[model samples]
Target chain A: MLTIHCPCCGVTAEETEFHAHGEAHLKRFGPGSSEDEFEGYLFMRKNPKGVHFERWRHQYGCGKWFHVARCTMTLEVFGSYSAQTTEPPQEIMDIIHDRRPDTAAGPAR
Target chain B: MSDPVSALKNIFDDTGLVRVSEIGPIGMVTLRGDLSDKVLGKAAVAAGGVNLPEQGQCNTEGSQGIAWMSSDELLIMCPYADVHARLADLQEKLAGSHALAVNVSDARAVFDITGDHLREVIAKLAPVDMHPDQFNGTMFRRTRFAQVPAAFWMPDGRSARIVCFRSVAQYMFDLLKDAAMPGSEVRHYA
Candidate 1:
């Protein structure tokens, strides 16, 4: 089970208490937007074996949504941060880069 | 108006290893604000008769208590009869501030589970760490009690005060009883 640290409550809890909400940092397109963009926004996801960003809801704890960065291969959590931002915080990115220098800066395919 | 009835009607069970009692209807205020802010802290202390507890902590003086439910939420407990008055007082004190103080006594249920191996009984249910070193007095945990969301704090070494939604009181009561049943002891936290 993934151990998640909720940025809002600062509680490190098991994944059972949290609900995964698919990929994070999603930008929505609507109305006059092209069908491709809308379809990509709804269905396209970065299912990377390496580092990936996802959203999580602390369902049983504080009932707040947050972001989690982790590696799908090793199951190593990069870090968790607030959902109020558009991208992963610099600290988490820096840690990821520092830990895996050979890996690409972001999820690639 | 009509009489106030608790979800479990003060049901007590000692037939099992531990003592499980559906505590009487107690006053609970779901106070939401910036807990770190001095203004909110002062209002909480004033209304709850206790200082604002730290994260994952609860401070209780008899029936009056203030538990840190989250970074922005506090569960202030008072006597059931005094809930409305306390809530109004909290609201008046928090005027002009971004805050929410509402009485949640009727919507919630509380239980007192006491015994020598109470931790073992609770450890079987929640996903929380139930060891004494981690789940000691003053520590507050919001977790799934079997299936529904519930919170619990050790009032003392032998007893815990569990709070959950009133709608799940029956389910919570049964979960606790079954966990604390004779011969069903896991002896992990024992």
Candidate 2:
């Protein structure tokens, strides 16, 4: 099982202790946005095989939601950060770039 | 307004390798505030008569027990008789801070299980690593017990104090009994 380090609880718990909730840092397209933009926000998702970002709840650990940067292909977790922020921190972004230089510098649109 | 009743009248009297007992009419509150704020800790101690535990730890001073639920949260448990007064006192102490004190006594069920085979039974139900080397008295874990979410702490080698939402108390109790059967396999520490 995947061992996820829950920053809030300060525990590295097994996958059973967590619940993955899809993409992290999702940009919301609320009222007044174009239909296409709203549709994209609702149904569009990233299925990257390499470095991917995700939102996960440490449901059985801290009961807090957090973000994770991981490689879908190799299961190499880049790192975890708090869910309270709007975007991944610069240090985490730098680590991702250092490990997978091919990834773009900003959030994938 | 009505008098409270115990879910399990005498679970403590059971004879087996394990003994499970309901632990309240106790005061329970979920306390939230910035961990870095000294006033938050001070307020918690003021209400519960004990220092707030650090991450993954639990502390008991007198009838009050504080379990750290996360970096900025803790569960304060004390005698039910003192609940409302303690809540008011805590709110007063934390008036100027970014804090929330929620009374959860009615929403929770607390149970204590003691046995020589405590860890063995728990291994069957949850994915937690309860090897004596990895977990001990100072630690508490929020984890799923079988299919329901629960949290527990081993107060000693032979006992664990477990808490879960009241809705799932019966399910949790039955699951523990089934896992502690005489022929159940004792999980080896990895």
Candidate 2 segments whose C-alpha is farther than 4 A from its true place: A84-106, B10-16, B187-190
lDDT of 1 by residue, A1-109 (tens): 7899999887887899999999988888899999999999889987877888899999999889999999899988989999998888889999999988988756323
Residue A93 in candidate 2, Cα distance off native in Å: 5.4
User: What TM-score, over all chains together, does every model reach?
Assistant: 0.93, 0.87
DockQ of 2: 0.72
DockQ for each model? 0.75, 0.72
Candidate 2 structure quality by residue, lDDT tens digits, A3-98 = 888877878877888999998888999999999999999999888788788999988778888999888899988889998888888888999899
Candidate 2: tens digits of C-alpha lDDT, residues B27-100: 89899889779898888888878777878898876568898888878899889888899999999889999899
lDDT of each: 0.89, 0.82
Across residues B1-190, which tens digit of lDDT does each residue of candidate 1 receive? 9989899899999999799999969999999988877888898999899877888899999999999888789999999998999999889989978999988999999999999878888888888888877778688889898799999998888899999999999999999999988988777765
DockQ for candidate 1: 0.75
What's each prediction's clash count?
0, 0
